[model samples]
Target: MRQSSAVFRMIAPLIAVGVLMVGCGPSPAPNSAPSLSPMPVPAQTAASDKPLRVAPAPSALTPPVGSLYKNPTNNRNELVLADVRHTAVIIGDSQAMPAGSWPQQGVAALGYKLHVAGMGGTGYVAGNGKTGNYIDALQRGDWVLPYGEPPLIVIEGGGNDATQHATDAQITSNADRLLAALKTRYPGSRLAMIGTLARGINNGGGRRTEVDALLGRIAAKHGVPFVSAGDWLTRYDAIGDLQDGVHLRPAGHAKIGVVLAQELTALGLAARPDSAPAAK
Candidate 1:
């Protein structure tokens, strides 16, 4: 499917984020809104390059500034705003593509709507010999912020770049440009970065590790939370979760969702619904 370079679109982040998966062939589902799903946990697997991060325990994080209140309509014990005003803007390449909607479950957990946009074969520095890179795509307005005012933003990429042997400078410069555009568009939103996925673990080894490190440095420079996938293979038992090494199987997708939800909770990005009351 060839999209006009001038046309910008907004789809629920992973509106199915559907089969738009890079390696998997197919366009994303046409739906423009994301679906919400609960998060979960993955049975333990061999330790990945990075030790498996086991949350010590579920502790309530401090509320963001004001007193929280539970939405009277809510069925669970929680705190936050009653009505949802925030959106989670997620962008990436194939990894961000459809294989599985990695953002839906976690975004739902945070009570924010999800919006995703990305070219299946594109990334910051590579495009699988097709499509434009993230920087150019954003510059050309291939897609824009669909969710009105997003409180949280996530940028996922790097796999294609390393596989295609993108120069460090190319990756760095393009990544910088992409981040600039995101901040410019959603100045008030909190941002986070998810790095390259690996094959064995440690980002599938080789060049991917370098790419993850580079992306991490960029994230650190920008002061946004960064989730590295260098050890993802072992951490998530990716060998069984991946369908083709890059795209995920259903189980892989579920594990990723749970892990991401936990990270967002830890970051205090998705502590409670918008309507939950502040702790006494």
Candidate 2:
């Protein structure tokens, strides 16, 4: 009976240990409910739960101060005005570039800030190695257009076209494309053309004057205002103003600016009354 009792006690402890081990074993997965955690475990959200992102639209940049904006080849350029109500955009060749140019003087007199783009040897259909023609440059994004709707957009050039001997057909085609593009781009703006400056036939003018006249006809067809400087050298007796057979000196440009301003005023194309005149 004593031995039997001792054996029973030993077996009892073993059985208790086995029962405790079984109680501490891992539980099976649930069938219906998910396991609950006191602390949240960070899990990747579904794609739909994420906020949507979109790219920004393009917009114009305003300059804080008056300065020059140059392009890649330094062929195309802009004259930024710090505070301007009306802008006069001029696209041409060397004639439109330089400070105190006729276009610059005329626009300034009309109380508009000037934004001019031109290469030395480029025209409607003529391209220099560094830059393309006016239409080409505009299409290639060679120059940046000024922000807002310009009050006046002037197409200037044809000197290089004549010099390069581009056909009338080529000039007309390119000029038409450029005019169409400008009209489409700035539907609210007024369009005009400043013809090539040239002497009369008697004063050694040939292709240059012809191109100027041709441009006048194109402007008329498009119903755009045309200012002819074709006969200015001979008519105004300003041949002496010519630094070369073609280009004008600074004084000559200043004199021409006065005359051109007068002509623009006569055509009722001066700056709007709301436009603030640049400070002297």
Candidate 3:
């Protein structure tokens, strides 16, 4: 009985240890739901809602400032705007040609004659070999007749100069020299310089403004008339008047020509036969 009791005591501790080991075994995976972290979201930006801004549309009539005028015809013909009844000379690049034509047509329609001495692709500065270049043409006496009374010499250029990247100083200097030369060569002739039309995308902006401003200064310096075509052309409205982003179409030419004639009449360069004279 005593032996049986001692054996029972040793067996009792082993059973207890076995039960403890069984209780401490890794717990089965919990049946409850699994834990998870929330996903992050990206922050919004103002640009997300809006489209990118674009530059304003280019004007149709105005060639981009500082744009080159490649002449459609390489010919260097001298256009004579001789109106004995209304004498005026129109000299310039292609823009000037068509724009000047408006005035010429107006004069003709009124039964008067006006001389247009415009050459296309011309520049005020010498040595750019596209005919009608103002510097070369002016130097050649194409617009002047020594024996006959000197007619008014209207000088229009600078578009090509701007395109050629002529510096501001160069433009200014060339204008001065041209004016001086005109005055010296034909003392009796009246001199006028026309400003550039509105420039388009082809003409880098700011540069045309620079050229126009310089033109104004030159006109002021010489105490001569400076016609601002940029303002007169109303380029925004008449953008369609241009053929290839620069030169004017026939219709565009007519519009500007009429405006030009009116301006000339106002300046006493042409006669307004129908309108009564303002009281001095």
Candidate 4:
């Protein structure tokens, strides 16, 4: 009985040790919380709350033809003569008063009465003097008739003078004296002296350049505008628009008229349509 009891004790201890080993084995690592990785974020887009959205691309604005007249009182639709007593004067040589004059066309288009006092063959020096016999019809009173109010005077000489071998000093001096005299005669008038057209041949005389330079100086001295007809006309010629080698064709004249009208508007000689607001 004692021996049987000892064997029983030893077997009991071995069974107890096996149960402990089974309990100590890994139990799914204690069922720990799942390790989560960081989630990726989405990209952002532009957003606006405003109702009125701006255009991606905008277009440029263009001004109307003959819409640059600087005159505050003159209306775009109405002729200057309808309101004023005197007429605008255009003085030039034959080319200026061509078969169809650009000045005349320009004035008419811009709703103005035209009074041309140009002598075809006369130069600035000759016109101012009685020796040329060009201004014979104009009496002393008529000399200042075109200037009671500030009139738009288009002076278009220099072509003849330039071609005639006039010296730079002579040309400038003549232009200066003439402009001074005109200013003295008519203080309020605005003068625009058109430069001479280009003569193709180099006559060894600097007449063409001299006349242009003098016109610029004269314009500065008189505080008036100077338009280079030669420059503009040459551009036209480059585009194959000249009838003769020298004179402007009808289309050319019209182009010149358009340019002149724009110039007139800029000079404050014409009025804008929407000058005064409506009585609302």
Candidate 5:
């Protein structure tokens, strides 16, 4: 009994010393919300009490309709929209200067005002079945051109030439001559051509189609944009806009006006009236 009591006493003192040593060691770190985690908080403000800025989302502006066109007849790019502030000159046959004034209405919307020089029987050429070719008429002082050498000059013919059976040679010669004369007359103004109307989109087979093709070639030679009105009407599904497949009804005239306006714009021909070229 005596020996057991002594051994227990010695072991008790050593166990006490070990517990005291552990307590003396550094205290355990406090239990924090796990080391990796943090609470979300509102962004801090500057001394001026201004809110922190966040970049605005990206935005893009789109161009307006009729702002541009890839000219179907020539594969050329044209600007169809611009300030409606310039004067325009239009030369054509009966369709252009029809009995009613609707077609010209739309053209007039393109600028400050538009002028037309045309007669029902006149055209780009005369011969087999046609007469009063445009070239001869313009040369003889037979036609009146207002606002000469304006910002935009549009020459449209060949309808009479086709109907009257004007020969290809005559058509080409007269068209070229007329183009040259216009260039000479309005050297500073931009020029464009509008081809003849047709029953269908294709240049199927006939004098009219041949005339259209011929005129297209001539326009290309002149480095100008030729709006194949036939194709244009077909493209816009506006065949119904015409009456008798040749003349434009009021609706047709409106369509022509809108389309022509766009074409003129696409060519970058529209400008402020004050910027237009002065009369020769």
Candidate 6:
């Protein structure tokens, strides 16, 4: 009996160890939770390495919406936000620079907007240091011409040419070029000339009057209507209205405006408020 009990004890220990080994082999315990691995992250795309697209700026060559245009009133360019019809283009010198100058006044009286292209010390054959002469300016696109056909295009300047003592040949050549360009570009528009504003022969008028008379003759040759202010300082008795030896004061501008308006009306050029506006 004692031998049997010892043998049984050894065999029972061996059986328990075998059972434990079986439970631990390639399988989890029945009462325990399962283990898990972390998920992997994706790699970045090549699209993220490319540059972003950016929009370009507006160009000056394209006079699009909100683009600026030449405004001679304050001698500054301003926004052109609306249509520009019924405007008379004036290419002149200091005489047409003012906002209330004779050309503007005359055009306004006729119910037309005045678009000036000339400036002080500029004429057909003369230019300010910063700008070219009238013909050169037109050719080089210095001035922003209005869209569509304007009713009237007036060439007004000779004071500078005369002041610089430009010969009649020089004046005529440049004037011819400018006139030809205007005629070609604005074939549908009427052309006119406003000669140099000056005093009479008896009122200290010198080269100014001579140039004015010369322009009148040129206008006749071109078949363009002319308004001579050669004797205006004397005719209107406006000698005292001269601010300097050349430029006029506000009162002088006003007087000349009225006179030009009347003359234009007589010539059937001024707008007739009572009737429909025509290009004649």
User: Which structure among the candidates has the greatest TM-score?
Assistant: 2
Best by lDDT: 2
- lDDT, residue 37, model 1: 67
Using all chains and alpha carbons, the TM-scores for the candidates as numbered come to 0.63, 0.72, 0.57, 0.54, 0.60, 0.70
Q: Candidate 3: which stretches are off by over 4 Å? A: 1-86, 98-100, 103-112, 126-132, 140-147, 199-205, 231-236, 271-280
lDDT string, candidate 5, 37-112, tens digits: 6675445576756656655555422334345444444343333434322557678888788633434654566654
- Best-first order by lDDT: 2, 6, 1, 5, 3, 4
Question: What tens-digit string does per-residue lDDT give for candidate 4 at 1-280?
Answer: 9999999998998999999989888554564643477464343445644445434443332223323323333222211233233356676776666646676676555555666665666665444333341233232222222323535566776767766666666666766666665565556666677676553224322456567667777777777777665565544443255576556678877777787677666655552233532110
User: Whole-model Cα lDDT per candidate?
Assistant: 0.67, 0.81, 0.59, 0.57, 0.66, 0.78
Q: Which stretches of candidate 4 lie over 4 Å from their true place?
A: 1-86, 126-147, 199-206, 238-240, 271-280
Candidate 5 Cα deviation (angstroms), residue 170: 1.2
Per-residue lDDT of 1-280 in model 2, one digit per residue for the tens? 9999999998998999999989988665775444575554344457755544444445433343455555333344544565434778888888888888887787678777787876789999999998899989987767666644578888888999999999999999999999998887667788889998889767777999999999999999999999998888888777898898788899889888898899888877888777544221
lDDT of 6 by residue, 1-280 (tens): 9999999998998999999999888787795655677454444556785555544566644556456655443343444535455677888888888899887787678777777886688888888887888998877666656655678888888989988888898898898888887787667788889888888767777888988988989888998999898889889977788889788889988999899888777767764343554553
* Candidate 5 global lDDT: 0.66
> Hey, what RMSD does candidate 4 come out at?
23.6
Count of backbone clashes for each model? Answer: 24, 0, 16, 10, 10, 0
Clash count in backbone of candidate 4: 10
- Mark the regions of model 1 whose C-alpha exceeds 4 Å error after superposition: 1-84, 128-130, 200-204, 271-280
Candidate 4, position 130, lDDT: 39
Candidate 3, which ten residues in sequence have the lowest lDDT sum? 71-80
Compared with the true structure, the alpha-carbon lDDT of candidate 1 equals 0.67
